[model samples]
Target: MSTAAANEADAGGHELRDLVTGLGRAFGGALVFSLPMLMTMEMWELGFAMERWRLLLLLASSLPMLMFLSHYSGFEATWGWKDDLRDVAIAYGIALLSSTILLFVLGVIGPGMRAPELVGKIVIHAIPAALGALLGRSQFGQSDEEEEEEREQSYGSELGIMAAGSLYLGLNVAPTEEMILIAFRMTDWQSLALIALSLLLMHGFVFASEFKGSEATPDTPWWSAFLRFTTVGYAIALAISCYVLWTFGRFDGLSFSTALGVLVVLGFPAAIGAAAARLIL
Candidate 1:
């Protein structure tokens, strides 16, 4: 081959290799991040027992979130809406395949199961698995340039990231019975204290810590950051927590007080997740 043709062939080979490596990372991330949920009994039961409409809604809602996440940080560097959409599709596909294989290997899925049960189980788990696949680039493959770009994101994009983080962590624990049991055991005063703690932790994680991803600066006031990012993030966390709970039918017949307690309980972790999102993602 001529020199120019040889160079062109090398470039093509490099591109193909990078694509394969990214796909492998995405698959690894999907399995690693979702393994806990895959093994959880509640998650397994929720797959088949949850309402069909709720399941569909969960699946539909994940698409936009995945698209937005892909825009910010995907399995590959995306330049436009088309790229983001393609990444979302790839991540979802990886999630579905990974979930099915793991569930089958674990004996959670089998030959005798009905279609809805089998599909439901896989679909429900795929939401978080897809999120993990998209996050693979951010967590395991982020370049310095990408990190800098993320740091320069707008306030709205920052909030979007927080919401994504909140949903990711909330989904992990939302399907469990322990959330309700903890809420039921706590007193009203304890619930209030938990809310205060969540807010404080959320604020501290982003603003007070000297972590590498901390957005705070000497010139920026603590209260300013608290009000702008921390409080808003906590609110987003609560909203996401409520939505996850509702999606799982956890609030179907509960009273106002009980539901509020459960919301607060879940919000604790979600709030922390939201705060840490800026640092981690």
Candidate 2:
């Protein structure tokens, strides 16, 4: 072969190898982030008992978010809309396959089960796994190139990252009865206090600390970061909490106040997750 032909062949080989490596990391991330929910009894029960339409809506909503995540921090660096879409598909595929294999191995799924039950279980669990897959490059080990890309993201993209992070953490715990139970036990005063605490913690994580990915510089005004990132991030967290609760039917029979309380309770962790996303991703 000519010199140019040899170079072209080497480039093709490297691209193929990178694709395989990226897929492997995506699979590892899917399992690592989703293992807890996969083992939860509540998640298993919610799979079959929740409304099919709600499950479908959840799955549908996850796609756009996954695509955005791929653009921001997929298992490999994406170059264009097509690359983002491809990564989204690959991540979702990895999520579904991994969830199916793990559930089957644990006897959580089997041939005896009906199709809806089996499919619902895998689909619900796959949401977070897919997010993890898309986030694998950033969370596991981001390259310098990817880091520069992330830093140049617009303010809107920053909010999108916050929402994704909130959803990931909220989904992990929303299927559990504890969210409702804690909400039930808390008084109005306690809920107010918890909301305040969540904001404080969220602000501390991103702006107040000297962490590696802290969004604020020493010269940056505290109040500016607080209003722009912290407050908005908390709001995103609360919204995601409400959506996750609604999806899981947690708000089905509650009174208005009780439902609000549940949102507050879940928002605490969601807020922290949102703040942490800025640091990590």
- Number of the top lDDT candidate: 1
Model 2 lDDT on a 0 to 1 scale: 0.87
C-alpha TM-score for every candidate: 0.95, 0.94
lDDT of 1 at 231: 89
lDDT of 2 by residue, 135-165 (tens): 8887678656656766466778878988988
Put down candidate 1 lDDT per residue, 191-258, tens digits, no spaces: 98999999888877875445344355656787888888888999999999999999999998999999
Q: Pairing residues by index, what is the TM-score of model 1?
A: 0.95
Among the numbered candidates, top TM-score falls to 1
The 0-to-1 C-alpha lDDT of every candidate, in the order given, reads 0.88, 0.87
CA lDDT of 13 in candidate 2? 100
